[model samples]
Each structure stands twice: as structure tokens, then as C-alpha cells.
Target chain A: MPAGQAVPRGPRTSRFALRPDERRSLGFILPFVLIELALVAGPLALGFYYSFFKVEYFQLTSFRGLDNYWRVITSPMVLGSIGATAIFSIVALGLTLTVGMALAVHLERDSRWNVAVRAVALVPYVISMLVGSLLLRWIFSTDAGFMAVVLGPIGLGDHSVLANPGSAMAALVFNAVWRDSAFAMIVLLAGLKSIPPSLYDAARVDGAGAFYRFRRITLPLMRLSILIAVVRLLIHFVNVLTFSLILTGGGPNGATRTTGLALYELGFVEFKLGDANALAILVFLFNLILVAFNLLLFRERRRAP
Target chain B: MTIASSPVARPWRRRARSRSAINALINLVIAAFALAPILWGLSTSLKPTQDILVYPPQIVPERPTLEHYAMLFQTGIQTPIINSVIVSVGAVLLSLGIGAIAAYAIARLPFRGKTVLIFFIVALMSIPLPSLIVPTFTFLANVHLSNSLTGLILLYSAYQIPFVVWILYSYFLSLPIELENAALIDGYSRFQTLRKVVLPLSGPGLVASGLFVVTFAWNDFVVAVAMISSGESKTLPVAIYGYLGFYGRDWGPLTAAAIISILPVIAVFVFFQRYFLTGMTSGGTKS
Candidate 1:
């Protein structure tokens, strides 16, 4: 039907009733399903298959069962990227959660400043990561960077975050937290709000310490929210591919080389189709593992009575 | 009752006395630290090129100017604002239309494989875009859609449909069925009932889904990087990034570009933030 077409009221009125004779709805979704199957499902399956076969752009080239997998499983460069991605993700996740949780707790008190804090918390998320890194590039500049020379003057002044390996990673982690912590705070704040005030009042009357209340009550209650936040952070960290592409360009001697950047280098830049396919498969498997970790955590919560 | 009379009842008093002071101090510090970059960005956007780097950089600009903002549009390179607007608006329309229908179907109509369909959509959460890079690029190129705003809108619409569909389905599902029954007796067809009654009633969910589509399309960088290469067709994020590459150390124009680039996203977020927040939490906790 057209946007405003009037339908006959007698029989067609019941869209919810059995439309046993109708195929239109099936037609509506069929194309979408086929495209998903072809584009998304096919590629993922083919990717895994290519990992088993010696493959390049258009050729199976040859069957090298377990060979590409072996290379990926052993390459120090691949392992190193995994390590970098892990550290980047874990540190960012930890800080975002902790900071978000802290902020959420503070705002729950309903102070007037809560509005200011909440607004500030959300602003950073609106900044595009590409622009965000560009800004950070300026802020961390040794020559004219404001961050090193200004706020934390004596301690951080003179040190360039991009030049050093540990600090480089720290800079990336800091950037991720700054962008995503707002998101976490938003989600966790909702979780906090869902809990009845009566519960907190009862805890206070029972003489629960702040620590006791948070540990025994807040943490457990926020499990689903925390799980969602972690999962979201993990996926975004995987795909924050642009940062390494631009920020450091996996620089300081590959100190910041992310898995995605390496794939781009191999697949697009170098035209190393085989290596790129292998790298993509590895990242896919790693992501699957993280997703599984999240589902398991959520399921465990559900299974508890 | 004796337990309450015991020290247990006043335990919060002791804990609060010690921790309240400490908590206040620590959280203030953290909030300030977390906000430092944004504050710095705002400060720097206000500064002139020379003052931007003044050693021990001044918190307040010695002399602020709109020079950077003035310089933003002076560039010969195309701004992605138009592209961003088109793609985001197009995506919002398409996603909401398809999502509303799909959600209503799932919410009201009983069908085989309904549960499985919802599950399939939810499972998309696992497939990171990076893993889909090669296939996505290949597909777009093969179809002659790469580098086009239409293609970008389609990409976002495809990616966001599942998320928006699932949630809107639930949001619509929870509305009392009597509304539909009343519409039925009033001689409205199912389609009319949906457009006239159901859609209007789910205003908050529509805002939530539409805003999400808008932001995801607007702030996106990765797919834009993979798909678009031409200077003429780049989105704001890509345009600003490219601008930075050429205009390095030109703080005046760069800050101007950053501020302009993010204005739409910020506006959208501020306007419907509550709906977005509630939508997100509903999807997570309702399951």
C-alpha cells in the first residue's frame, strides 16, 4: 500500500490475524535475508575456509591445510598485535567502567551539579574519533602540545606520550576512555536508576557501609548493565581501526600497530591478500571469543535462580 | 528490634562519616580529570594560533578570535555536512520505516521463526565491522555503490536495522492491545491503525531509533574511510581528518573545523538524549 492508502475495513483490517494466503510480508524480508546471507554470512564462511586453504584475491591458489592457520598461530607480529589490542581493550574497559560507575553513583544523589556533570560526560562522545585523535595529536605534541605542557605540568610536561611506548599505549587508552566513558556512564546510570530508592534506604537503615552496599548490592544489580558496557567497549575497541590508521599509524616502531591497521596494511596497502585474509580470520575468532565471554556472563546471571 | 538497637543500625553513620568526605574529594578529582580534554578543546578553540601553544598553556585564551571558525569554510575542499545530512536523514527514514513494519509484525503478528529472527538480529552484536571489511568493500565496489552518499546511507541502514528493529518491536509490544482493538472497531485497516495509531503512540521509541540512526551515520569514520576516497564525497569526520593532514599545526582552522563538524551530533544528542538512554537500557535490561 502507498503511504496513505485507505484499506478496506471488512477483512484486510486484521493484519495480525492469520494471513495464510499472503506472501507480501515474506517478500518484504526475503531480499534482506538473501543479502545478509550472501554478503555477511558468505564472507565470514569463506574467510574461515580460506584460512584452511592457501588463498589469495581470486584464487584458492592451492590447498595448504593448517598452513595459514599455523603462520597466524605463531607469527610474533600477529601475537604482538593481539597483545596490543588486548591491553588497549582491557585498560580502556577497566577505566571506563570504574569512572562511569563512580560518576553514576555521584549523580544518583541528585545534586544540582549532576546536570552539568552529565552534560559534560556526554559531550566527548559526540566528537568523532578521527577528529578526536587529530585533537589529541595536537594536545600531546611535544613541540606545541597543550596536555604535556599545561595541566599536569611538572609531572607530564617534557614527556611526549606519542614518543614513548608505554605512554603511547596510555595515550590510546586515555583517548578510548574519554570517548567511551560517557557511554558507559549513561548505561550504568540507567541501571542505577532502576533500583528502587527503598532498597537503598533499607540498606542504610540496616547500617550497611558504603563499601558493603556497593559490593553486595550495586555491583550485583548492575551486572547486566556492566556486561552490556563491556561488550560494547570490546567491539568498539576492535573496530576503532581508524585511530591506529591515523593517530600513530601503528607508529613508534609498531608500538601502536592494531590488528585492524595491520590488516589494512596487508590487504589494501601491501596487496598481501593471503596474509590479510589470515589476519582477518584471526581477528574474527578473537572477537567471537569476546562475544562468547559476554554471552556467558549474561547467561550466568540469568541462570542464577 | 534489638539488632536495630545494636551497633548494626548506625553502621551507615560511621561509614558515611568517614567515606562521604573521601568520596566527595575523589569523585570531584575524577570528574575534573575526565572532563579535562573537552575543557581544553573548548579553551583551545577560543585561542589564536600563537596563544594555542603558549607554554604552560593558558587555561583562558589571551586573545580569542572566531578566526578559526572563519577559516573553516574558506577551504576549497568540500565539507561533508551536506553529505552527512543527506545520508543521516535518508538512513533515518529508511530504517524507521522498515523497522517499524518489522517491529509491528513481530510485536503483533504470530509467525513461525519469529523468535529465531529476533535472535539473529541480536547476534549481529558479535560481528565486528573490521571482520566484515574485505567483504563489505568488495560488495560495495562490485555493486558500483562505493563512495556514494546513497551507499553510505544504505550501509548504515543495514547495520542499524537489527538493533532498532529489535527494540522498537519490544517497545511496541508493551503497549496495551486495547488501542489496536479500539482502532479495529473504528473501521481502520491494520496499516492505517499502525500509521495513525501505533506509530503516533510510540513517539519516544521512534525518536530513540531515529536519533541512533542519525548519529551512527553522522559520526561514522571507519566505513567512510573504507568506502569513500574522493575529497568531493567525504563525510565530515573524513573531511576534518583530511583537513588536519594538510593543515597541520594550523590550530585556528582545525579547531573551527572540529567545532563545526560535531555540532549536528551534539544537537541531536542533547535534544533526545533521554529517549536514547531509555531505549538503550530497555534493550539491555528488558531481555
Candidate 2:
């Protein structure tokens, strides 16, 4: 029987009269819920459990309460990785948002040319991150790189970009922005599409200039999309490992080793499972805090106006 | 009124023309920025080894050769490509099969804890993959599924199901309930109604979600690298990563392998561009 229909007001017959529809709904969702619990939640809790233990070669030997967390907190290398990740995230996120918003605004019109340009913009994002990073690596190669050729006349051809710490980090950030700005553009473009053209028409009739209308109308309306883009990109930049691995290999004396690469090295390369798990938990908590901070910032801005 | 007759319109038209010209110039730069790297890679791939390292690198190859591509194929690039196809297609099918039903239920049925379930799925969507990689690896190893394509498929499916559900849930919600109601009134069961009525109308939604899942599975590098160790089982991205170590500064074959790895995904994206934009924007903006 369908839900919300009368049940004849009889005795508590059968003691579990789940309507047929409810039963079918339960059946439909049961497998999905089970898989999520088993795969996502179960492993997450297990990771927390593993973080407190002395794991060697993937085998948990003994429980050492808070020892792994303490070690991770005290390790200078881990701390340096966090700092590097913060720098990367900030620069990459800022560039991605600015470029994405600019592209979205310029290409918001649904013309044929706009459609084709939007597709081109997304090409890097659609390709595999490893491939994109490797392509950039080729472009930055000291010997036969595109940059070497382009900068040859300017006396910078022999300057090896990947061999320098500062430029290596910059290369990493550039790779991220090149790939992710398209994603941010897509999201922000959706926000732009939702804004009615009549708002612009009305503003023009009232003698409001383009900048004034954008500030008073578009920015206010795009707050959520901007927040979404920021949060998503921040999370991604903080945790992504491909660019560091493929483009720079965390090279130039470990200058570009982000937290994600550090975690991979800890768990897979060094076999320091306990330390990796602890660091992972810490990073996960940091992400939650970062997102919460963004939400609060946006909320405060909303309240101000 | 003619442009000559209206004095006020002249400067406005001139200004608009200048603005459009500037916009077109910016668009060209953006497009060039986007395409230059891939085009450079293609050019490098086609160039002979001697031509590749020539000073003032040739934007266009002097004598394009198929040697790099031939070398890639000779070394068995097809194995990883086939492995990637199997894993990606398997993950997409699995996620869509499982997510579609749950999404339909959440959209159409009245059930207890429905809102909580949705919140739970959304929360799952944000869990960082790095944090889960260690435990997931261990879990798969214990089950003896690590280093296997099936294991990769299962892991990818689990990772992508939340997104699939999110997109499909919005699609189902937007769909009119009357069609399902009509099916129900005709004495069809909920399952039959969903299969016969709802699923038929959700072709675009399925394609969009499936494309996203396939792309995620195909482009993934960290998980595949961590999980798979065997040569035959490695996916295309991981296999291409291996080229860095094996080729070791041989940009010709490396670029060729990279170009080959991205072809399938680029083709899929081009074909389904419209659905991709709609699905991505809608799914993201909805929640």
C-alpha cells in the first residue's frame, strides 16, 4: 500500500506492517547504504584506530596511545610539508578563482564562439592530471623545453626552472591553476546564468555603470558560487599529489613536497603507516576547519550587507 | 534612425565595438593558453628524437615521424589502455546501477531518516581520498583484491557513487511525478514503474553521471598507483607515470604515451559536452 493512507484503525496486526512501498524503498536503498558503511565509514574508523597503533609493514603490532600523533606534530619535515601545502593552496586558489571568474563573465553569453572557447578552456581539466603535469614538466625542461625556446632571446634560456626551488613551487602552482580554473569557471558560470538579464537592463536604465551594477548586483548574487568554488578548490589543492609527483617530484631539495605527497611517501614509500594515518587524520580535520572557516566568512559578509 | 542622424549613438557604438574587440582578443589568448600545452606535446610526440631537442624548439616538426607512437605500441601501451577501459566502464556501470535506485527512492518515496541519509552521502563526498587510501589499501589487501582491476573497479565505484546519487537525485526530483503515479495506478509495482517510466526519461542524466564516473576512474592516478603493483593490471595513467622512470628523459615516447592516454577521455568529453556542463553545474549548484 502507498504511504499516508488509512490503516482501518484495527488492532496492532502483524506487529510490523511496513507498507509495501516502504519495504520496496528499503530494499532499493539497502545495498547502497551497506556498501557506503562498509567501504567509507568502516575504513575511516579503522584509519583512526590504526593511527594510534604501532603499525609496521601494514601489520598493527601494539597500541601506542597518541604516540604517532605526537611524532607527526613534532616532525619538522611534516611541518614543512604543511607550510608548503598552505602556500600552494593560497596561491593556486586565488589564481583559480580570479581567472575562472574573469573567463566566466566574459564567456557567459551563449554564442557559438563562446561555447567553443569554453570547451577549449576545459581541455586541461578533462585530461589526466598526471599527463597534464608531465606536459608542463616537458614545457619547463631545461634542454628542449618550450620555455627555453620562448625565453631564449631574452637570455633566460639556460636558466633551469625545475632546478630552482622558488620556480619549482611556482610551476606546481601554475599546473594546478591551469587545470582547476576551468572547474571554477564552470561553477561561477552557472551562477552568472542564474542572474536575470532584466537586472542589467534595469540598472542601465537607472544610469548605473557596469562596475556599479556588478558590485551591487552580480557580486551579491554570486556569493554562494564563489564560496563553493573556493571551498572545492582549497580542498583539492591541499590534498592533490599528482602535480608535485609528476611535475616537480617534490624536488629542488624537497621544496614542493605538499602534505599529500608526504602522506603517500610515509605510508607507501617509508611504510610508516601509523605516522601516515595520524597525519591524514590531522589533514582531514584541517580541511573541515578550513571549510567551516570559509562558510563563516561568507556568512559574516552576507550579514554585513 | 541612421547612425549619421543619431549623434548620441555614434560614440556608444564605437565604444561597444572597441569593447568587443578587446573581449575577442582576450578570448583568443585564453584559448591559446589552454591549447598550447597539449599541442606542444603533440608536436614533440611527432618530432624525430634529433629534432625534439633542437635549440629553439620547433613548434611544428620539421619531419614528423610515427616512431615514438610505434615505440609506445611496441612496448604494449594497449594493455594499460584496455585495463583502463575495463575499470572505468565497470565502475561507471556499477555506480550508476546502485546510485540510480537509491536516488529514485530518495526522490520519490517517503521514508524515515531520508534527510539524514542524504546528509550522510554529502558528507562522504568531502572525505579526502588520501586519508582513506591507507586503510582502503589494507582492507583490499586483506581481501586479496589489491593489484587487481576488479579491486580498482570496486574502489572507484564506491568513491563515485555519492556523486552519481547526487546528480541523479536532482534529475529525478526535476522529473514530474505524474508519470510514475500513472504507472502505479495501472497496477504496476514501484520497481516496475521506476524501470518502465522513470529510467526511460532519465537517459541524459544517466549519460552525464556515467561520463563523470568514467572520467574520474580514468584520470585517477594516486589511488591506482598506490593500489596496483603488477605490470599487467596498471591503468593508463599509472602506466604513463611508469614511462617517466623507464624512458628517463626520452620526451618522445613519454609525450606519445601521454597523448595516447588522454585521447579516450577527451573524445568522451567532446561528445557529451552539453550534458556534462548541465549536469556538473546543476549538481554543484543544487547543494
Task: Write candidate 2's Cα lDDT for A29-134 as tens digits.
Answer: 9878888887777766777888999998778999999999999988988888888988999999999999999899989999998999999999998888889999
Query: In terms of DockQ, which candidate is strongest?
Result: 2
Q: Whole-model lDDT for model 1 versus the true structure? A: 0.71
Best candidate (score: lDDT): 2
Over 4 Å off, model 2: A1-20, A290-305, B1-15, B282-287
**Each model's DockQ score:** 0.30, 0.54
**Alpha carbon lDDT of residue A42, candidate 1?**
65
- What level of docking quality does candidate 1 show? acceptable
Query: Candidate 2's residue-wise lDDT over B1-287, tens digit each?
Result: 27735776888788878988998899899988998889999999999999988876788999999999998899899999999999998999899999999999899887777867876666566666765687777677767888999999988888888888888998999999888888999999888988899999999899988888888888898889989989999999999988899998999999999888888788988898987775565322111
